[model samples]
Target: MGESDLIHLDVVGLNPAIVKHEKQEKAEFSINRKCYSHLKKKTFATFVASKRISSLWHCCDEAFSDSLSIHRHVSNVHANEVDMLISAALDQMSNQSEADDSVQTSLNECQAKDASSWMPDISHLSEDKFSEGPGEVILYYRYCQIKEPRLIRDWQNELCSRLHLTGKVRVATEGINGTVGGTKTATSLYIKAMMAHPIFQVMQVEDFKTSDGGADCFPDLKVGVYKEIVPMGVDPDVISYKLAGTHLEPDEFHKEVQSLLNDGSSDSDTILLDCRNFYESKIGQFKNCLAPDIRKFSYFPDYVEKNLDLFRNKKVLMYCTGGIRCERGSAYLRSKNVCKEVYQLKGGIHKYLEKFPDGFYRGKLFVFDERYSISFNDDIISDCRYCGTPWDQYQLCSTDFCYQLVLSCTACRQKGLTACCPLCQVKGQTSSRSPTSGRVHKEECECTNSRPRIPTDTS
Candidate 1:
């Protein structure tokens, strides 16, 4: 290709000024180098051809001549970007009345180029780096538009498998929420990889809340595409993070909690709310915060709907385990328009304890893993269910069919107070013990009544 043809291909749809500058520079250089201009043109054509081939296989640096191999490579590796581009093109076409096949072809070419521009080279991440020290568990979530969740899920599965990490990852059209545990080096590399990804580039190092643990913290890796990353049991399109409450940094949240504590009056207009479930708060929670008695996160909407009077005209300060719940929870609460104002902890309790280990939050932070909970301070805010002894350790109910977690001190546990309640203990004794019987057919206990099912709000 000649200089003008190469320039046109390189600067297609780019700024007119940039194209003009490129032409001017070419003209200036060509005047004195006319003798070798033909050779330069041949070299440029070869370079451009190789560059185009490399662009087509952006994920891996391999260039394939076979169309089938190229298709396989792109689908297996760059499926997420491909889906995103197709979705964008469709969206653009839908908005334009005169859009045709030519318009779509042009749009796809432009979007593909743009997508490949931001893809980072992960070829060097072939080997896992092992560290000597203990591993860490990272808890993080990002709310952004993901055009194809399944492709993201595939990518996450492959990445986590390669790093030998274990944990749960929930992907949705709205975003991704994950808590992976691995070696210090592996976790560090995972964070770097996530930040390098175009979809998650908005994330910072601090966004991944790390705690002392490793792959063993979780039983296995479970990554899946879901309706909502956090499963608020509401349509993500209806209650999105965009409509979430204002975020307050750890310092600001600390001050707000301190202010609430300082105010001894019962009629304060501001309310400190724990957005976590009852069990989570039972172990540890902010001092004097109103923790709802909901069993599952899905019930949060009903809890709010029923208790609207409590939040009416009140400035609500909300917090959760790692901030994922509060994102959609706060949005749901705000949708009611009952509260005067709604604000959530920027990074939730995790970020709060990082800054102030002995801050307003007290006791152990509950986590959904084998570890059960991680402590920041020496505070034991909870008590044994059987005896009112100060304890925060959680153990599963001894009843085989019951999945409920109960707190029983050493003394009580030794005395066979292992069930969630006395009734469950009696039932466990009378019922036929079968090895095959599991929590899937869980018998209703007294605690079951507390979690009354509410119709899902599809609105």
Candidate 2:
């Protein structure tokens, strides 16, 4: 985003502690600085020949233009090590599928249709091919606009087989921004089929860049119509956060925080707030971020509406994961008749950690999907329960029967490898070696760790 569209990082309560870390790391680029053009040049596109990403984009500073390069480094130099692991994972999935009849498709003729129009159920999808590795899927989008709706729904029903995906996509007038999962082949076919559509022939796309402008795109496939492609305009209680608006990078937001810190006559009057769920805020929050009786986005508004008198005339700063929530959240505060400057981090702590690792954010930031949690910038923010080492990377149980993600530290792993859980570990390890053994499927995979859980009754 351009500089004007930024929210102040300072409002997120990131300063001094964070600023110090960035300067030392030499990663201290101003998050608020509008280097859109400079960063854009590094903007690359690739139609990944086939979804065999050895290296997901690594945030290795600016040394590499993209993560693909990092993947290349790991794969080319350490191909043998990666291959062994991949083989092991795939074998595990194949064996697990044998045990679970549900994982395999048992189609009935009644559900079949020819030259058809039927929306497929999301529940029926599975990424079977991921037994080899984290399957790669590519989605074809038309420019920033999606004018076709009926076609998408039909595609969902007739096209997408029983493929698995992380389900969080919506279609809207603006465009699409949902995430799902599928096997490498399924995702690839879906993208190819999308381009074959005559209606979208003239459309521009950003997703294709992943393949370097080639036909070899996604490895798996599934395209469908969601409530909202991006799900931006939804109910007041949909996603977490009270606000939703354009975001500011960390740099610009930090400047504002400095002002707030200096504006106060004394520190006591400074009202701090942690505008996130108790679970999220607990991991790490600003020194003064408030922890109120709120869990979901819906209850957050009520908390401010009923208890705003405490900071009716004080400088109150708030923040959330992404800056989107503050858009709606801040508006609710305005209606309370409490006159105070409402501020939030543009992209929440995520942007802050990009530059300042050991900043105010103390632990791992929880995510909604299978990725579970990612480490904050520098320190081992959160501890691994088993070994007590700082670890935030989430792994689902490796057992195909139990694909639920569980937080595990380095020492917690069963065989010095990340699996879905101990159940998956027992299943994968004990199974007799198979032809497809160790090909894919870590068994430790899920959509997200924390979804938008609304407040029912927070006691």
Candidate 3:
């Protein structure tokens, strides 16, 4: 490989650019961090810039060798002066805007955000027989740290290649983070491979766990090279992350959860708090877990602070996706002198899923991959708010203006019920003629308050 083969454009200061990539095996991005976070916001931006000729150049000779192809591909990219990068930037802005909007809307209203994360359409995937699923492990992990950007990228590729996993990999100067999924043995073997093998030993992996239902939990694997591992994008000053905490096994932790729920016990002042985003909890959680209404992981610190007074004298049991949030959250809470004893679910919900496939937990498991959601049993968690029956499936509204995705079973779906529910019809419709006109408030439309509260965290 020549000097030109080290092809990475300095995106540190670029306003934002279209970044088109991904073939059959990759996930293409039109705009990267530099452009998307700073510039436009829309659902999908159309391709504005044309591809420059230089991008089409092939550096490899006719020799069909793998090594040569890799090296030559690098060279071609480095020397690429094509305007494709600019075009990619514009397209990304549109996609980002849509994603951002969808996420924010989903947060407050309890609805599905962008459909991008859905692997195939949810309706389609639900019908297929996932025989290789069930007990198969289905999750991934990404740890971030400061390193040479190019080195990190190489390490990511090596990590996936060595594990023989299929997904994406990205490397940036700030740090690296990604998600990859496979089967039970494959996932475990990959972890062991990363830890013991010296071939790609630079990568440090944190343990990830989920239950038997993980198969349908996440959609698919997604890897993106970001300037920061977890996308805080914060300067080193305001907050510096330190992943330090004591590790607890399943036996020791489950006892604590049990003690908290049982009354008249010596472990009286204990709090079971969940530290995950709202959607994950909607799927599955501990029976008595205290699900916090948080929209994003980054906001955990604030929730901890606000709720500190609630559990000041009590033992605080905190948890999240992996043990990532709790490791940091416990330390933060401890520092504040709020809780008497701070404990986090050792490996979060994933570990629980692995240990107790059909254990105490009840309901589906929500993940951040292509599989929208997975149920521990065959049944769904929450029902259509109006119907008051079991229903875990989600569907986007046909009405363009009411572009919301929420829980709806086949029965409710068949009714052509889009916005208002049966209950809403009762309270909303004083008279059939002008029913939806008066007395039916927006709050009446959303029955989340009345529906049995689902766990509100990923873990």
lDDT of 1 at 247: 72
lDDT of 1 by residue, 284-378 (tens): 88887888877789989989999999999999999998998999999999899999988889888999999999888888999999899998999
User: Could you say which candidate leads in lDDT?
Assistant: 1
Tens digits of per-residue lDDT for model 2, 322-375: 444565565566556574555556556656766666655566666444444456
What would the TM-scores of all predictions be? 0.71, 0.41, 0.53
- Candidate whose TM-score is highest: 1
Local accuracy by lDDT, each model: 0.73, 0.44, 0.48
Q: Global CA lDDT of candidate 1, please? A: 0.73
Error of 3 at 419 (Å): 6.0
* Per-residue lDDT of 111 in model 2: 19
Ten contiguous residues minimizing lDDT sum, candidate 2: 102-111
Per-candidate count of clashing residue pairs (backbone under 3 Å):
0, 94, 24
Question: Per-residue lDDT for 1-459 in model 3, tens only?
Answer: 111211244446544344443321122323344333223211111111122122122233433222234344543653343234433544453366455552211111111222222112223333223225433443434343333455445544554443334544444543344445544544555566544422223334545443343333334344455654544324322343342334455656776776666664544687777767665666667766777765566676777677777877886767666665565566566667766666667666667656776765667666554455655565355667457686766554433223334566677767756443455444323334453333322312354454443354322
User: In model 3, which regions exceed 4 Å deviation?
Assistant: 1-146, 154-177, 182-193, 196-221, 231-244, 264-268, 377-381, 395-405, 418-459
